[model samples]
Target: MVDVSAITYDALRVAAEHVLAKVREGEELGTEDIFILYLGTIVNELRDVRSEVARLEDKIDKTSQRIDETNKRIDELAKSLSARIDDTNKRMDETAKSLSARIDETNKRIDETNRRIDEVVKSLSARVDDLAKRIDALQTTLLEIQKLLIELVRSRQ
Candidate 1:
């Protein structure tokens, strides 16, 4: 790499020395030499400014690359999150379906149990009614037998 600072420093030092030497000799500097010397300092300052600008541009480029990398990572994270959400949704749907099927089966079992209970109740009711009718007929027969016994006792006396 070219060392612009070193070159500019050397040029400035040489011009200053030459001017000092001419002044010590009691000689007047030519107008062209003074102009050239003055312009040399200006050119060196411009070179330094250009070097600073290049360094700043390089920093900007690096910063931009870092930002792009960050964006890429963010995009990847978003996609990963989206995929996870979709998977969770699918699992929830499956669970709901399973729960619904189980609920349907439980309802069917409950309905069957209710039907059996009704049938049992109807059979017990019929048995109770039959027992009541048989008891009533037995009571009437006993009353008729008691009347016959009383008539026999009165004739004997």
Candidate 2:
């Protein structure tokens, strides 16, 4: 039961070289040497797998960070748009109030002008009535003077 993690690359290389030399010299491989070589191959494959897993984990961490940053920016933009909408609503309300006040003022002025026109019409009607009475009195006086002249002319002849 050798610790697989504890075996170094140098040690594995030396073992492989020794095995190779023994084979070349026409010697038989012991069971222990074959087991060590098999363990070395397994350790090397496991190291490669671990390195690939670490690379994938690093990539996943970077993608997660980018997603978080994008979410933050989206939240900030939404808040800004909300603030702008609120400001526009306030401005529109103020403008509506201003226009309403101006309309009220204009109505008041129109009502005042109508009242002045009514007063002028009433005064003119009264003056026209007085002039009509004076004209009737003058016509009656002229008719009486004409009758007197006609009677005096007949008595003289």
Candidate 2 total steric clashes: 0
Model 2 residue 52 distance off true place after TM-score fit, in angstroms: 4.6
- State each model's CA lDDT, in order: 0.89, 0.88
Where model 2 places Cα greater than 4 Å from the true spot, the runs are 1-54, 136-157
Residue 31, candidate 2: how far off, in angstroms?
16
Residue 45 of candidate 1: its Cα lDDT? 90
Clashing pairs in 1: none
Q: Give the Å shift of residue 136 in candidate 2.
A: 4.9
| Candidate 2: pairs in clash | none
> lDDT of model 2 at residue 154?
90
Root-mean-square deviation of Cα positions for candidate 1 versus the true structure, in angstroms:
6.0
Candidate 2 lDDT over 43-152, as tens digits, reads: 78988999999999999999999999999999999999999999999999999999999999999999999999999999988888888888887788878878888898
Q: Please, what are the lDDT tens digits per residue for candidate 1 over residues 1-157?
A: 9999888778777877788788789998998668766777787798899999999999999999999999999999999999999999999999999999999999999999999999999998898888878888888888888888888898799
